[model samples]
Target: MKLGRHSPAPKRQKCDHWSPCPPGNFAYRILSGGGKERTATICFEDEQLVGEPGSGINIAIVNYKTGEFSSTNFFHMWAHDHSKQMMDFIRSAPKGTLLLMATQDDGSTRLKDYAKELVENLGSKEIKNIKFRSSWVFIAAKGFNLPDNIQREKINHSDQTKNRYKGWPAEIQIEGCIPRNLM
Candidate 1:
């Protein structure tokens, strides 16, 4: 995968102690209309899970219209494991659903794979109206990272919702990461 000029390089933050550290926080600057006036809280305490330093991955998704959010933790499991549940939820979503896919700096590749599969399956006509729009998120973590190439590959493979529909306007926030503020 080609790393677009806009792609972010690997980043990390150091902690002074080994004690349970707080999860990081993430916010997205959303562009609407002619100006960027909206900011959404992508990660909150309710969306995080605590485990051994590096035991699992936390994934979160938010409904743009209702600001409703849903999250899950994947531990020693493949993204495909959640296919059924994820598909069910997406199918029920109204048109113009913006699904955001986020992950810990380390889980980026895995999450991207999951996103790719979702787009492929949804686009194949096996499902209807359940289209994957676009995904955006910041990758932050203390250690372990996804190579820039893999990240780009996944993003490119996933279809952007905007390009797929005319003027459908629904945003679904999908986030995957360990909240820096949640320990």
Candidate 2:
């Protein structure tokens, strides 16, 4: 439920399986990239880091540069409820607050729709720089075929091979300012 920056998550603290902190507490972290600091939201669950950025399942993207984030859960159904909290969080942000959000791609436009919905709710008054990130796939259609040279160079089947990931979130979106522009 926290939306603003706080002390970095205690990394030295043991969180796997058993720890002193309460269960479901987000462990704040600082990720350094290109001499800039980016705060990341992390939580330990099932004896593992369940909500670290760029890793784990159903993770919420956190920016060290901008103190904005969303309530995320591993389950989509559960995340829907958490997202309501996130919606409220966004509303609570003061004017000109640099807000950011990243959503999972469930093969549907729900995430995009929700982001648009948030913007629409502002009634064209509130302006925020929202950056987004999600997974994309390049595929050949039924009638389409790649040229031999291009196929040999671009057709990386191993990179495209994955059955387990398909079941994972199809998209992961992050909107907000980081240390730099990642467009």
Highest lDDT model number: 1
lDDT of residue 43 for candidate 2: 32
Q: How high is the lDDT of residue 104 in model 2?
A: 29
Cα error, residue 101 of model 2, in Å, equals 1.1
- Model 2, 1-183: lDDT tens digits are 989989867555533322343443332321111101111223322223222433211333333233244333332322233445445555555442232222223212223446436643533121122222123211111122222221110111122235334323223211111122221
Residue lDDT tens for model 1, 21-130: 24443333211111012222233323322221221123334443333444333321234344445445544544422333332212222234554465444332211222
Q: Evaluate model 1: give its TM-score.
A: 0.28
